[model samples]
Target: MGAFTRPFFIGFRRINTYSLHSMRQFVLFIVLITGLVTGKSAYAQWEFYGAGGVRYATTEEIDTNGKPLVKEHGFLPGLEFKANYRRGDWLVTLGGEIYGGNLVYDGQTQSGTTFSTDTRTRQFRMTTEVGRYVSDAVLLLAGTEWDYWKRDILGRGTTLGMEEEYNSWRFLAGAQTRVLQASWSDIYLTGLLVVSSPEHLEVNFDNQVFDQANLSTKAAIGARFALEVRPKAYSNVSVESDFEWMRIGRSGDAILSKGGSPVGTVAQPEHVRKAIGIKIKYRF
Candidate 1:
């Protein structure tokens, strides 16, 4: 049985037959892959593997009328980590990463009417998973993220600092199917599903008096294609693709208004998005 095992099931990730790009839950899928590949406190050998690569990610606006609003692109950097125990075909795992792509947009409306500063897209991830082998060529994983977020308007065009933050949980599941295995090349097909809470965050404007509440939740489904090549000893390269579609909404009305007056508090704004990305990583 190799090192990893099959994850029983996770609904957040596979919300039907939809593609990952339609879900917007790519990071959870990534954690699923990292944990399982290194599973086995009982079934795997204590080992560490990593890789870094560059990729392209695109986000498009989905019209309420069932059309695409705008298309955008970004450049990205990615890394992978694995920690697990080995005992046979069953293994437990833990892993995480930080990744983001430059934000590319078209229509100004998509950027938000309250937009005062230019924002780009970025992401951070932390998670743990478990897997067991059902067959030599197939591996399944199930896990949850302690925290995850997709941030926008990270920094000024030249400075690299983020001012806003979002908080949420992620439930994920995935399957990896080995298509080819050669001394020089390895290829696999990966499928994933992710379900998340609407992310709510606090933004402190330059003035300390204005406190903005950013509360929302989202769910997405997606898939990926992975290609790996071993060109030399002690090194390997991996390229991956991600696609997702998502529905996001506030848990409750953000604020209450009475007679045109700000009264009570409820929730935040609601929106939907679809995105796709391709990335590469080097393993050492």
Candidate 2:
């Protein structure tokens, strides 16, 4: 009986050793596959980036009868900054931008009066996002953005001076992918969509201000496409070109009396905006 019991205990120890060894091998295999999926381990976790650019933005204001009341077009210089965090194949970014310019527009009143107005514009934008690489060269991101558009209409001599401001929040999604990659250079493409929430509007003229109290703001949509070129792998400098377009639904009262009184209701003015720009960015 002692000999049989000793052999049974020895077999149980062998089986336990084999099971532990197999478990270790399985865990190591999983680690190897995870490393491959992430591409590389994170080294630098944070980066700061800045950009400067020139933008040509076009704006149009339409009257109730669907006729254009004003078409403002001009070029502006802009600046932007970003803070970025990277881990494995994922990145998070926070950014802000601002631009201002002057546009000239020819206006025709209902009485066939032709006049010109100088429209000065200022815009501020803020954004936050998280992005992940779906492939070695492709990335997708979803984000949120806030935008403030301010327009000041100055008189061209005897005309009236007015101001219009629109503020909105947007839901954004986009994709970025490499278009060309070589030893000397890399080219990338990026596209974006922005859908705005209910906007807020403020208008001021002749010492009177009209805003959310008496006016309604509508939704807006925007799209943008950009191209980026990196000249060297070791350098953090890049050249970029962007084109964007936006359209906003009707806003404000079409018929505000000369006395600033609310008159019979008319269709609100519609807004359309388009822009193209080139920029340079440095990352550290």
lDDT of 1 by residue, 90-117 (tens): 7676666656655554432222321123
Off by over 4 Å in 1: 1-44, 59-72, 105-117, 150-163, 206-209, 218-245, 250-252, 256-284
Whole-model lDDT values for every prediction: 0.49, 0.68
lDDT of 2 by residue, 1-284 (tens): 00001101000101223234434543554454344335433535777777999999888777667777767788989887777778889989877777888877666543446666666777777788989999989999889987777667665444445555667799989999999999999999999998988677654543343211224568878898999999986488999999998888886554544355664443336778899999999875
TM-score of each: 0.62, 0.77
Clashes of each: 53, 0
